[model samples]
Target chain A: MSETKKLMYVNRKAPYGTIYAWESLEVVLIGAAFEQDVSVAFVDDGVYQLCKDQDTTGLGIKNFSATYKALGDYDVNKLYIEKESLEARGLTLDDLMPLVYEDEDDDWAEKDSIKVVSSQEMAELFEQSDVLFNF
Target chain B: MKLSIQVNEGPYNHEASVSALNYTKAALEAGHEIFRVFFYHDGVNNGTRYTTPPQDDINIANSWSELADKHGLDLVVCVAAAQRRGIVDEGEQERNGKDGNNIAPGFRISGLGQLIEAGIQSERLVVFGD
Candidate 1:
């Protein structure tokens, strides 16, 4: 096994409109098996993926928003949502689903997985990553 | 330098696959080692042997096949993505009970693990897509 590296999946597209959002999530889930330090960043139109109450029945598509909640089980708890991106789209943290994870280090205590970061902070996060998977 | 590439769009329709191919060629020309090239999303279309572009237009898939043949490149199409898009190899066709296999020469259908492995093993990972 290779040494664990900071791997970030950068999501910048809207869900359903294109396959990128779902495919990015698929990679994140599949990549989890490798036990690498993983972080998912929702930026630009990507912020729409977490919007609560995503009803895809009308579109005849599988509603995958629920799948994001399962990331905690895979030990993928780091989710960084860009504040600027959300604000630009007239959305707030309340508009997004509350995603949480059980922390093994803290005796299985549930904690917030989504961290709303500023654009500057997001840039720093990008610099910190060893590999960036853009979607 | 050791590099890995990911192409997330289909050939011709988007410039992504072309850009990725050109980048891989340039990197190899400059004496760089490409650990792997993982095709995901519609990019798996690049591995279909059934592509029949006109004589005037470039057959991008064939170009990739030729490049892989010459360089011994690991051209991997994500199996899940390929299956979703109907780009199947003989093994996949047998396993999935498909009537035919359309995987181009020098291309193999593999799992997403290969993509993650490329990210981990390569010195740099480049993605060409929208």
Candidate 2:
């Protein structure tokens, strides 16, 4: 059997006003479909992607944020958020979707689970990954 | 390990530039050398010297330039992409009958060979696109 590939998806843009967020999600879903070990990290304005109260109906745009919730169904459950980003945006864990892991989780609590991390930790994740995709 | 990065989206148009920067930084930090960073499509706009983002916004072009300057990085902007986007050096500007040159320092206008060479030589090649 082929070894599972370690893939990391880095998102650094806002959820709306651009296609990067949606396209990045598409890549992640496809990667998951291949059974690749995938993890997604939201940084900078990308944190907006997990905000709970998004409303895109008024703009006549499809609500791509919902697609994020479906990522888990594809086995893309390793979602990461930069702690500093959330704090900078004045967003707490409660303000985000319930699927995300909180920052207070123990360092090695979940061996293969999604977890919020600091920028320094994110750098390490990038180094450890066999394949890294920036979107 | 050799690595090739293709930047196909312009700075500020999305997070392509930021992600490219972070990826490059991480690769270098992990002791992996970048074989080449090829800027194509709208990515050539990153080499434009006239870009000046607001103070509140991230100046992605400057970030890229600074990274290249610090690492002695090979920053290649596609010639065709630059010409189409009106980003050219002094010689190209003159040749194209353009009045001014907006190509930034530390960025080279080159052909697709750079990208092809990177793909052939690198163990892993990642592309950053819109």
Best by TM-score: 1
* Top-lDDT structure, candidate number: 1
lDDT of 2 by residue, B1-130 (tens): 8888989799986788779989999998898898789887678899987888889987777777888898888999978667867888987988889888988777889875565455545678789874
> Which residue pairs clash within candidate 1?
none
Off by over 4 Å in 2: A100-114, B1-7, B10-122, B128-130
Candidate 2 lDDT score relative to the true structure: 0.77
In candidate 2 chain B, where is summed lDDT lowest over 10 consecutive residues? B112-121
**Compared with the true structure, what per-residue lDDT tens digits does model 1 show for residues A1-135?**
769999999999988978889989999999999999999999999999999999999899888999999999999899999999999999999999999999999999999999999999999999999999999
lDDT of 2 at B19: 94
What would the per-residue lDDT of candidate 1 be over residues B1-130, giving only the tens digit for each residue? 9999999999989999999999999999999999999999999999998999999988999999999999999999999999999999999989999999999999999999999999999999999988
- Per-model TM-score on C-alpha atoms: 0.98, 0.53
CAPRI band for model 1: high
